[model samples]
Target: MTRDNGFSRRNVLRSAAALAGVGGLGGVATASDGESLRQIGPADLSDVPTDLEAVPAAAVPETSSGIGPGSMLFITPPGGGEAACTANFVWTDDSGTTYLGAAGHCFLGSSAAGGTELDEGPDLADVEVRVCVDCQFGGLSALVGGLRGEVVELGDVVYARQRTDDGTEVGFDFGLVEVPSSAEGLIDPSMPTWDGPSETGEINAGDTVVQYGNGVVTGETVLTKSRAGSGTGNDDASGSWTAALLAAPGDSGSAVQVGELGAGGLTGVEAAGILTHVGTSGTAGTNLQKAKEMATEAGLSIEVVLAG
Candidate 1:
């Protein structure tokens, strides 16, 4: 996930202090107007459905089959901060274990500096990852269920070149998370709101593509256009692609699918890359091919689930 500058340490600490004053860290409270806002715990999946069949017959949240791009993922790092990012595709390992792909930095305490591997000291093995079940195309109002998982594994941190707020070109980030077995059946291998059951391929410049992310406002059904291969050959960050897609702080880990628009719409869509960082001009992503290779090196096999 992109480091939210707005959520400074001082602000976070202040929020924690305020919560402590109100009740406890994970307490629930009602505003003076009577609206309820509760502190969510790792096990507080009360809003999530316990059965896949129980999900409404509506959009079938991106977490389900036709696993769409903007699926909402709630990530709790080991160090005690909670954040959210969008999930990419659903893949299965050689042993038939399923996992949802996402940016690895979602579990980090801070953004990794350019040219460095993500420090493994955060104990990501138990990092909490959850997906909302009752999501719609424009909002997450329907209360269905939540699928909870953990970050069982992660990919290498490839340097993503981008210009900072001050226009300084610097290196940045990438990674993935594994969905637990318990929540596997709740999701499908399809891209939400688009054409899919697609393949994985390289993204070329000027290539029209669709980007998905679940921002705080957009939920998990937001879609935007991006042109791949736009910033190719201009930087040393090999195996990475640049696009003009608009991304927010919560859009980290969103997917960049490569495909063509046909008469049927979004035909041949496939997993191309995972959004790593949002720069002043556009977003940078880690090549999906490289991600698969990294998974293999780590003793895992991944395949995009296509709509049959």
Candidate 2:
């Protein structure tokens, strides 16, 4: 695996340009999530990568771009400076409706344990979608995600991109959905069920963390995590003690699991940690209660919690 230093503005910019752009952070939501006092939208929204940097910030909507499977991506108005990390593209639901998901903390730019709160959860919207300048093809993960994970930008104009096997940065346009919040199902949790008591564990920077995404019935895709320090939350309950994984920006909110049958259930949720000098690396988040809360806010149900 490649060791990410996180200080490469040049490299980040290069990746951003290659992406035209792409998508971090945390105060995790436990029983004590939001208070409804926080206002959603701009003034807090910052651009995604350093490259597709936006000028004045804007409000985030509760929607995902029509395109999927790219290195986390977003677009600005024509040339609204650059794009900001709208939110993490948590995965999609049935019927192919791409859900624009993010941590309650990222959606809520406020103060918290150890996470960095930015955009608001209610600000999601299915805006327009933009494709990579001259890119095509998707990867195994992207293809499964319904989202294209190629490198992307926050602002307009294809600048550069991070490294990828495809050798091309992919961009996407928003299909524009008119949903209020897809986080409802989680609060209830009975939407549907995947087979797995599963479980949650931790990994260090050197250790390889693995899990399954996409969906339950489909298949398990194994990817390694770089293991950042404490996740978005400050307390030990937030994450386990792991070195730092090369967990990238697009990886926040991913479910960590053991390499067993069916991604071996789950270990913990991945979060984009607070960066000191090093770059993003990754976060080791546990606390299933917090995950359940997040799922509730997003309107998704926790089919199962992989208890360790």
Candidate 3:
């Protein structure tokens, strides 16, 4: 794999142009409020092992009252610029430490798309994570103070021969932001519009899904069975899932939920994946099950805690 140092504005523009030509499906959700939060670039494969055993699903309470998956999170990198992304879920380690998962690229100072720069480990001292209440796309809302903590771990970038229609290889990009003890009572593990306590389930090519991100209003879409392996570079086509959900730049790391569509509404919805890439055809996500295993290998005993 070829590694590129920092991604230039030119590269992001090129990516945007490329995406526009392909019908603008893979672009990161852009903040409608004139914010310039750039999506972090993909990474190259490293020695990180991918064969770790699946961490058993944890028991979720009957309900939760903290922030849900679709909530918007403001990530301020160590360098001082602020970017936004969707929070995946409220997670907890065996010792009861809380965390929120976002895209790993959100914290990188340079591109690791084809190199080992990440081996040196990114710094997290001045990094800050925050949540906004009543915030909408392109609009402002009240801040919930900083959910102070550092990025305790990052998901390894797994190399897969699989390439997307554009020939970009699939990658697993996720990061764990440790939550300060003071903010634990403020997060809710349930999704806003779905059932409580997201359960782990495999998503198929034709499954209906719902996603929540700060970039789009009403983030729901259907998976086109035909795009499963047609060249989206999604890792494990059988396990990964995508949809026509409208994602913008700041929407990275949004939670993708698996659900049943009906006249009444979505039913049996559960957390299935986290949005990582946006394409003209749809948005790609890493399977939640795989994310769990990756976290385990990183030496963090974590689980997606759900609402009761």
Leading candidate by TM-score: 1
For residue 104, give model 1's deviation from the true position in Å: 0.9
lDDT for 32 (candidate 3)? 20
C-alpha RMSD in Å of predicted model 1 compared with the true structure: 11.8
lDDT of 2 by residue, 232-274 (tens): 2223343222223333333332333322223554223332121
Q: Report the lDDT tens digits of candidate 1 across residue range 1-308.
A: 21121333443334334323332122232322233422211111222322322235354433333333556666666555566566777767667766677665565544322222223234455566656544443212221122222222233222121222232221223445555555555666555555464577766667666665654233424343222223321123444556656554455666777657688766437677676654444556567766665555445566766555
lDDT of 3 by residue, 184-290 (tens): 65666776556544476655566666655554222211121001121222235333545555565545676766666568767435667776666546666667776
Which is the winner by TM-score between candidate 1 and candidate 2?
1
Candidate 3 CA-lDDT value: 0.47
Give the distance in Å from residue 10's predicted Cα in candidate 2 to where it truly belongs.
6.0
Ranking by TM-score: 1, 3, 2
TM-score of each: 0.62, 0.33, 0.62
RMSD of each: 11.8, 15.2, 12.7
